[model samples]
Target: MENKKALVFGSVLLSGILTFSLYGIGSSIASDDSKHEHDREYEYRDKGTNYSTKSVGTNKLYMEECGSCHMAYPAQLLPTQSWQKVMLGLEDHFGENAELDAESHNSIESYLVQSAARRKGESRKLLRNLGNKTPLRITELPYFIYEHDEIPCRFITGNDKVSSLSQCSACHQNAEKGRFDEDDVVIPGIGRWDD
Candidate 1:
């Protein structure tokens, strides 16, 4: 009778473990699906063909010039006034040494100013951090700093693909296409458990 009771107890314990493991797996899958749906909805609702390849003038300059090195700084990352400051300081761009032609410079400046961070709605974390203040340096961006806090300084400078800490998408999985959620982050050379 004792042996039979032990057998039943073991079976129940095993069943509980299996149930918990399956629940965890199911929850992870459901979370992934929700995130995917959110991204899809954001893309569909925020459509305006202009930010894409069809962008002209300064927008083109951003893609052709800036994008060559890193993801184009999202227009919503800075207030409109801040974008103006950055555009005006293009001659002294942080490190790339950008020197734009007058027409291209004006075009890019206009596009950036028009789509400045101020114009963005409250949905963006970057904009939220700005808090009505116009920031001059992209590095000053709160969201940028928060996202990069985990990255080691050596990796950022050592990696060829990543020149500055501002390049979030370089290591982050969904960064190339403009998704920076925590779930989307997959640090290279690190295991999921580490994350």
Candidate 2:
């Protein structure tokens, strides 16, 4: 009788464990389905494209030093080598005195190079295409120009608020967050860009 009781108890415990495991598997599948559905619904509602995915820099020194003058563009916009060159040429940063002290300079330099663009995925595939080049200006990069090919100079260089094409946030509402989706674009004088 004692052995029979032990067997019954073991069976009940195993049954419970199996049930919980199955439930967890089912829940994960349901969650993935929900995300797909949400994406489909968003595309149907939104008139523009998505940012897909982009990594934003989180270094405090990089923000304070680089951003103090111009918009602290995302470090991933450039490759590791490009960042190295930029940090090496601060005194003449695009024809400006962006020189920083050793400590601050080293910190910002490390951050930019470490957080530079990767070489894969939709967000970073462009980095791989930039073979044989280490462009200092993000605007001059072939991939960046291709991405902004639809927009004319009038909407960018011609606009007072956006003095040049380098001014990303001038139109990208979530540029700081690394999102440059087509739907989020809204030029100051003009409206949504669809091309």
Candidate 3:
């Protein structure tokens, strides 16, 4: 009977030690995850201007419906106000009937606003020349114009494959992935464009 009591006590003590050890390890892992999330560029901001490195389309419906027409364009390409305006005027979206039900519209608008570009880095350059202007077209951005300035009108407007600069995927291989590195650009009919 004494031996049995001793064995039971020993087992309880071992169990307690194992539980504490596992708890410590879990806490350490949790701390590391918190640090990683903080360092991530796409951390959600409740109310502030900040750029996000994360790819767009956190909402499936937004990507499927909006992308059905165009590249769906990265939400990071515009500011929160610009996204709001676009959502408000979806019925007349660039002469296209992009009408959406109120629920879907609100959901898409929320996603766009949340994913909108920060007023920093390249995003700042995009809005540089414009003051208090919310351009409906992403191509209207000064940075976009500057980037495409070297390419003659013949290549863009003339090329049947690329009707407009807005057709980002025409030249950018990874436009859908939001990677617009100039090195990857290859005009459809014109072929590779190192410039």
Best by TM-score: 2
Error of 3 at 195 (Å): 2.8
- Which parts of model 2 are misplaced by more than 4 Å? 1-58
Top of the candidates by lDDT: 3
Candidate 2 structure, TM-score to reference: 0.70
Candidate 1 vs candidate 2: which has greater TM-score?
2
If the candidates were sorted by their lDDT against the true structure, best first, what order would they fall in? 3, 2, 1
Error of 2 at 147 (Å): 0.9
The runs of at least 3 residues in candidate 3 whose Cα sits more than 4 Å from the true structure, single-residue gaps closed, are 1-58
Error of 2 at 26 (Å): 18
Total backbone clashes of model 1?
2
Q: Write the per-residue lDDT of candidate 2 for residues 30-76, one digit (tens) a residue.
A: 99988765553111111113221221222666777788888888776
Instruction: Please give the lDDT score for candidate 2.
Output: 0.75
Candidate 3, residues 1-195: lDDT per residue as tens digits? 999999999999999999999999999999998986555433223232342323233356777989898887877788788899888888888788899988788778888887777776445556767778888788887777887899988899999999888889888887786667666689987888875
Task: Go through the candidates in order and give each one's C-alpha lDDT.
Answer: 0.65, 0.75, 0.76
**Comparing 2 and 3 on TM-score, the stronger one:** 2
Which residues of candidate 1, in runs, are more than 4 Å off?
A: 1-35, 39-46, 49-58, 119-124, 129-133, 150-163, 192-195
- How many pairs of residues collide in each model? 2, 0, 0
In what order do the candidates fall by TM-score, top score first? 2, 3, 1
Cα lDDT of model 1 by residue, 94-136, tens digit: 7556777887777777777666654344435566556666678
User: What TM-score, computed on C-alpha atoms, does each candidate reach?
Assistant: 0.61, 0.70, 0.68
